[model samples]
Target chain A: DTAVSQTPKYLVTQMGNDKSIKCEQNLGHDTMYWYKQDSKKFLKIMFSYNNKELIINETVPNRFSPKSPDKAHLNLHINSLELGDSAVYFCASSQDLDGADTQYFGPGTRLTVL
Target chain B: DQQVKQNSPSLSVQEGRISILNCDYTNSMFDYFLWYKKYPAEGPTFLISISSIKDKNEDGRFTVFLNKSAKHLSLHIVPSQPGDSAVYFCAASGFFQGAQKLVFGQGTRLTINP
Candidate 1:
């Protein structure tokens, strides 16, 4: 079974549209994160949440927001999606907010903003 | 600025040979390092990690070496198998929030030949 799963593995949307990508982890992790992999294949962290609280928010555009209704789920909601958002968004989780623990990852949600 | 860097864009190795992937970091504060492998269309899967306190970490055929003085780290796969062919990323986080926010390298595509 996949430890982390994201809904709608591939999303294609038009510009200025608002959409949300959902993520869930069955590993019973306390921390979750969202990362963006751009066309150059550079993966960068966008956000991190622990116990439903935001911990790290990279200098991303204000149009992007993340919501954690509970510990098991973290959803990325993009408002007025832009062409720059056309990349893969990944959801990851770790057992703790420590450097030593392993971070398991979901398959990925490839968002294509047209 | 890109903190973690994978100088080689790709590496190829013969089956049963050794595959060496190198990474460099500019941040002096980074104390924890990790290696993640990823297949196309999938999120990264954690392979192994090392802390600034240690110089090397090994798991099965995978080994990670860290050289603080050089601000460098590397992942070595011995007896490389075809299944090991994938994109590998190097990440680093410092003595802060559980490596909560990781800075990743561009990524190295490893192709293992039969």
Candidate 2:
């Protein structure tokens, strides 16, 4: 069974366009996170939600927002997309907020802002 | 500043041989570390992990070694096979803003030649 899944494996859009990526996990995890992998292959955390509440925001631009409808779902919405936003976005989940918990990652969405 | 670093961008190994990947971290607050493997067009899958208290952890063909004093870690794979070829990422975990956060390195691609 797929533990974590993301929709739209690939996304292409123009500058100033708005886009959203959806994620879901069946692992019954309490914490979920969004990460971005840039052209340099540096994967950095952008946001984290615990039990549907915002917990970590890693100084990402205000144009990016994350929403969690429930414990199993977390979605990312990017407004006014820029070329620098072209990267792979990954969603992850862990059993809890414990620092030692193992995180399961989604297949990732390749976002290309032209 | 990059917290986690994997200096090698790629590594090649012969099948049935051993493969070793190294990682370094600058943060002393990190107490947990993990290794993940990712193939093209796929998300990263958890390989192994080690706690700061432990010097080493092994699971089947995969073993992870941690050195808290030097803030360095390494992953060793024995009897490497062609299937083991992929991009390997090292991640450090810590608690921030009451949430667990992961800092990932720029991955190192491994190619196992049969």
Report residue B41 deviation for candidate 1 (angstroms). Answer: 1.6
Chain A TM-score from candidate 1: 0.98
> Which candidate gets the maximum TM-score versus the true structure?
2
* Residue B3 in candidate 1, Cα distance off native in Å: 0.3
Q: Could you tell me the fnat of model 1?
A: 0.80
Cα misplacement distance, residue A63 of candidate 1 (Å): 0.8
Per-residue alpha-carbon lDDT of candidate 2 for residues A2-92, written as tens digits (9 for 90 to 100): 8999998999999999999999999999999999999999999999899999999999999999999999999999999999999999999
Best prediction by DockQ: 2
> Would you list the C-alpha lDDT of every candidate in the order shown?
0.92, 0.95
Residue A83 lDDT, candidate 1, scale 0-100: 96
Model 2 alpha-carbon drift over 4 Å, by segment: none
Question: lDDT by residue for model 1 over A1-114, one digit each (tens)?
Answer: 789999989999999999999999999999999999999889888999999999888889989999999999999999999999999989999998887778888889999988
